[model samples]
Target: MNILKTTALVALMGSIAIPAMAEQRVLKLFTDASDPAPKAAFEQLVKGFEAENPDVKVEVNTFDHEGYKTAIRNFLTADSPDLANWYAGNRMAPFVNAGQFTDVSDVWEENGLKDSLGSALKSMTIDGKQWGVPYTYYQWGIYYNKDVYKKAGVEVPKTWDEFISNCKKFQEMGVDCLTTGTKALWPAAGIFDYLDLRTNGYDFHMKLTSGEIPWTDDRVKAVFAEWKKVLPYTTKNVAAIDWQDAVSNIVQGKAANYVMGNFAVATFKDGGMTNDTLGFMDFPTINPDIPRAEEAPTDTIHIPAGAKNKADAKKFLAYVAKADVQTKMNEELGQLPINKNSSVGDDPYLQAGFKILSTADGGIAQFFDRDAPAQMAKAGMEGFQEFMAYPDHLDAILERLEKVRQRVYKN
Candidate 1:
């Protein structure tokens, strides 16, 4: 009897010592989503991912946004987590090229992301393979004063020529037709991005920014040529003002249109413009055959090349890619989801943006600073600012940029 009791006790102790099933997995996630909103979204993501995958547990490490930018370098090459948060576009090229990020083209393919996340496909791809999954973004387009457009008797334009004609009409009425604040030097980039996207198409624009095309190329000159048409009608003193100040130009009816991101809608409301007075439109089409692309700075998640638990990391990516998951995550995030099947919130601007961006087949761009390297982005925006002030300097600007391109991408 004593021997049988000892055997039972030993069996129970052994069972207790085992602790976990052999199938239990851990996925480590590194993120810069330290802000309240994104943090909550990530928390919800982890919880939901765990619920569906009871066998896997996620451990997340959050970093302050600015610090994470520097920290990602050390971790990606040395002690990589199973997954990491990153930006789309040229911002991700280094990791993709260095093989620090796993090629997630298989995840995208098996999940049908090519159809649902279609808008961001081009931005998320390099060398014909996707590196990560984009979750959220906001649209960038023309936000205009409807009251001013009505007063000027100009209808919303569908083509670049019609828009320029309205610019002439607005100019005649002593109103600035196109207003942007370049004091910060980035907003000028929105105009240039759109001009290049509308004129030369997304591939050419990417090539230009990637230094594959010469700035002195005539195709590049054509982008500036389009800019010249609106220079005489653009708000003057832009070099001295910031983007928010330019918002006042539209608010007070001194300007008819502004090329900006959707985030400016709140600023317009605070400045006393309402949905009735404000209107959003696609940047008028310049090339009928090139397809429409929009500016929507995107945030994404990736599997690290050194990840120990790549299976679960990819499972997490697939979880986030679901339309229902994205809908919930972005609703908390107050941003539009990249999943085409995901539903957006009731905010009219978001609704409009959802329609505008979700349908863009050409691509989504991550804006100038995110799309170009830091040195090149700065030089490019400075050139844009100078060109905004002096359209006549197109040659000098392009030549200077050509030199920088040669130097910046000499590697």
Candidate 2:
């Protein structure tokens, strides 16, 4: 009888002890911040979070950007992470609909995130339910080598005519005017999107993404025409190389300019150039009639519904939302902080990007990949790569993209 009683007591005590003691939960985080500079910044922030909460452990499992997308889809369907990095806009809609992510509306309100994140970015929150918190954002624009420009004696182009003239000057200097890679399709898609923005303005970009306009719209054709005008200035090998390799062409002085996101700053620095050696500018206006616009979107962090430590994850999310944390993130990573109150430093390259992002006449539109559904964006971008290779097939590319748009958006 005593043995039985003791055994019951022991089991009860074990249960109570386990609840009282420190519990560790592994947080699987999938992110595209794979580069050393951003990785170091994330580690530093995670360390701070770990220090504050001794009982909680965050295990960040990062993958390459493309790999993360595939892995996240697999993981979310089964064995999803406690937290992860995802894009805002239509990108999150499917996951949210499937209940893969937690609805943190209350947490968002309690943390004052609605007030913290700007109105332009508030679209990230869907149907009055907050989905994620954005950490950082960088403007996409033209990055030019000042040395190359100086040698060609050409100023940064502001208008379509000026831009073409500058390209001629660079060609005369025996240099490729634009350094881009269609091997990945994104760089080429970016050029296309920026051209569309410069042609039809931001509203049209949104309408097109939302399926309010067809892929074969004349405005889109006009944008493609502008792209054709500039294509001769692009490296002949753009079809054969990736964005990184194309960027390498610029870094090696084989090309004069690269139109890319500010994230490429790290790659450029790695290739050895200071702010004095580099110049940044908005995509020159293709339509003199249209107003200037901006394409800036936040990189969001969200807690998956299956997170083992929801409370702890929320705490970490809140920690990153602090302005000081944002400043540290931006300063170290050289990207713009999502916190509007935070001031980006005096780097000329960053300043130029900021000028483009801050002073735009319209709301910031997320990148093409983020603004549109991922599957659709993928198909569209691939078609863009094909079009870059054979501009005459623009009609076929648009037809395929229209099919993808119909399938993805169902309109």
Candidate 3:
């Protein structure tokens, strides 16, 4: 081969290798999201991140939302991703304690994120150190089909008694009054939080989260008793149905309402329902004298300790923390953005959702699951399912919960 020809071939190979080497600096992000809006928003953010940092490529892996908890627990102590999404509250405690996540407090201060994030979400910060950044979050409440209520001649409920009366009214009219997705676990546990919050107030809820109060408390028992009264009104095949099916029951007019997170709005729309046809209400006054406190928690992002691209991950997180990115995320995901300066648009339902969450007299993080460790959350959720199916075995369920709680809190 001639020297000139050989040089040309080597140059061609070098050109290919250069881009491949550039791509090797890619960032890996793993999240548990199947919903279109949030997923699209994440992809959009990745595109924006890559566009701004042309030298760094971003690779994202989205897992089943429910499965992500287990995956993250295992992944955190091993070959963790550059950045990963996780639940806030006691949910993050295990990983934080294990030193599996990078301490982002310094970066959080540098970026002035502490100024915008709500105090309620500070639970994501462990041992006075920030481990994550929250993007979008929505409130948990009762969403009723306006058209169904109109046909049934029932007004929107405000107090606990009113809510029960409304349920009775719906039952009299042969409508399944409440719809739930027990198959997902969290939805069922959400009901428990609402019951507990309205019964014991936010302080006791915190105590419950801290494992200071036993699940066998009278307050806890009262919550179950009240929950049992309305259990008959929930969707008939709740154990077999996931959230989507439960939402469909309401969308198709088989059920009158759903107790769910604000994200359910998008699922409702995907099922051919719209905001005008639906309405949101706070968890009714279980005790009329006390003001209603809403459940408000953030979906958080964290950088694991061993992340290969910590600098790029921090950059990406700061990019996501920007007000513009937050607003875009809210607009795309149909939920409220955590950045105080971020704007949520003029959609009434979205606005109402924002109003409900932001204006709550006080907010408690979701309980049983997020309020407790991941393992305890799992045990409590399963107990809720069993207790719901057989109220007669309440004591046995409580005993089992106590056992698990003892094991979980022993450390």
Number of the top-ranking candidate, with lDDT as the measure? 1
Model 3: per-residue Cα lDDT over 13-101, one tens digit each: 99999987867478999998678987988888888888888889889999988898679878887788999998676777777888887
RMSD of each: 2.1, 5.8, 5.7
Among all windows of 10 consecutive residues in model 1, the one with the lowest summed lDDT is: 16-25
Q: Model 2 clash pairs?
A: none
Instruction: Assess each prediction's global lDDT (C-alpha) against the native.
Output: 0.93, 0.78, 0.80
For residue 16, give model 3's deviation from the true position in Å.
Answer: 24
> What are the TM-scores, per candidate, against the unseen true structure?
0.96, 0.75, 0.75
- In model 3, the worst 10-residue window by lDDT is 116-125
Deviation of model 3 at 146, angstroms:
1.4
Q: What ranges in model 2 sit over 4 Å off?
A: 1-39, 50-71, 74-82, 105-116, 119-123, 171-175, 210-212, 248-255, 266-273, 286-298, 305-315, 331-334, 343-347, 358-366, 369-375, 407-411
Better of 1 and 3 by TM-score: 1
* Candidate 3 vs. true structure, TM-score: 0.75
User: Which of the two candidates, 1 or 2, achieves a greater lDDT against the reference?
Assistant: 1
Candidate 1 Cα outliers beyond 4 Å, as residue runs: 1-18, 21-23
